[model samples]
Target: MSAQLPKIFITGATGLVGSALVTELLAKGHHLRALVRTSSAQLPGSVEQVVGELGQPVDLSDSQVVIHAAARVHVMQETTSDPLVEFRAVNVDATLALARQAIAAGVRRFVYISSIKVNGEGTEQGKPFKTNDVPAPADPYGISKMEAEQGLMALAKESDMEVVIIRPVLVYGPGVKANFRSMMNWLNKGIPLPLGRIDNKRSLVALDNLVDLIVTCAQHPAAANQTFLVSDGEDLSTTELLTRMSKALDRPARLLPVPAGLLELSGKLLGKDAVMQRLCGSLQVDISHTRDTLGWVPPVSVDSALRKTADHFLSTL
Candidate 1:
């Protein structure tokens, strides 16, 4: 007999990840209940909409799987005086609340979308982050996710609901925001960058690949009670990424091979060390566990995904 399509409840349905997730699942004939803040967002007619934030109660009693993609993502120069407190309200406290409710609703699986930052800031060239590594969250965002993971684990121990955590590295695709979009804009606009000399390996995941894994986990028996890290499984240096982006944009990559040390110093003096560190550092993930355990591979190649991202970027402008 063929496998049955599960009824999935999703949060953050308007954001990039959630939106794409909705589309992917529906394309495979799964029933989706998307929780959004507005009804005006463009979505297929078949998708059931629960218009509200995570605070309000939506019926998940019949949902086979609950995919929590909503969170307090990292914001640059947040104006809130108590950013941590504000972040906790969403990432930590709100997450646990929803998880507890899902458990009460008898949801079969709760897949929490976590960040790779829970592992650490970055990795050395040869030392990629593994799923078993002790969490060393550096920023407020990472710390909150780590706390949420702990809370969910404790809750899972007391309930029949299976909790699966997936910590994905930087996710990029059409309509990407923040840092990835910034890089796309810079390269698309023909801005000369100083990251040519940096020798680093960073792991990034395409949206399609991440969504594929999430769907696999939604039904895979082995994925239950497992915490895994996911990526494109292809690491690229800053220069290489820029070159690829330029190729996608059909533009010349005018790279200045300035010393990485000098660039970092300038960033520090200008209060942008975090930005420089991301460009000049290595952050790789070891996805062997996920691949071996699930018998899965990234569905999209890096080149094709990047090209699609660039095309979408150009269309947006």
Candidate 2:
């Protein structure tokens, strides 16, 4: 941090990651211009809001850095007829469009917040995903993100604007929703869960950790044109995660030692195959490059992050 911070233009300011990044940057006295869909979008008082949509023309007059955090995230039950096309429209097409605008506006750096899905869904034990792994995007959302990363890298080669891609695994923290919240509810209710015997490891990134990496790339010269995977650097199994969450909530973990095969079968019978696979799958990432490159490490431990999440969840009750 310097006496004068660079002006940053960021998208998805109201999102989980974006909002956290904004708060962090603002606290550091950085000027931020956020692209929002509406002028009335809720944001901090000092954040300059530019009412606009992605893939559309935007003014980047004096911005020195652009952080692309907005995308059409994966949906559990896709309602669209053509999901890939829809994902491409926002994640790929719009992302490159904005990068081109940043180039034209002479922005110095572009940091893309990508997903680990760019490296495929799950991994085997003792084999984690690295930055150099061949792209094996599984679904429409992952495909779109991979395409966007390619487009950005290509554009970076042709311009002076530096590009840094960060792929983060499951990110959890205060205000988290979906499965994490559901699991918390289940634990809080002292319901028995049949996930005790599952032996799988999954890496997760706390909001503080991911935001720290993003900010590091914003100005770090070594981050230029490099892709990094980030996590808590500690992997956990489904049972471990539930047990830890229960500890945070001060509830006894009522876990039944169900067989993994039986759980998968039950999932298939209930049309929750994907859910079960996620719960029992191992998806780990190697952040050694991130550490060796920028000398960065996760600032928050898993337990600390879980406690923060639990505290927030309890406060809402």
**lDDT (Cα atoms) of all candidates against the true structure:** 0.90, 0.94
- Weakest ten-residue segment in model 2 by summed lDDT: 1-10
Distance (Å) between predicted and true CA of 235, model 2? Answer: 0.3
Candidate 2, residue 74: lDDT: 98
- Superposed by TM-score, candidate 1 places the C-alpha of residue 234 at a distance from the truth, in angstroms, of 0.7
C-alpha RMSD between model 1 and the true structure: 1.4
Which regions in candidate 2 have their CA more than 4 angstroms from the true location? 1-3
The global Cα lDDT (0 to 1) of model 1 is 0.90
Q: Write the per-residue lDDT of candidate 1 for residues 137-240, one digit (tens) a residue.
A: 99889999999999999988999999999999999999998878888888878899887888899999999999999999999999988998999999999999
| Candidate 1 backbone collisions, by pair | none
Worst 10 residues of 1 by lDDT: 1-10
In Å, residue 249's CA in model 2 sits off its true spot by 1.0
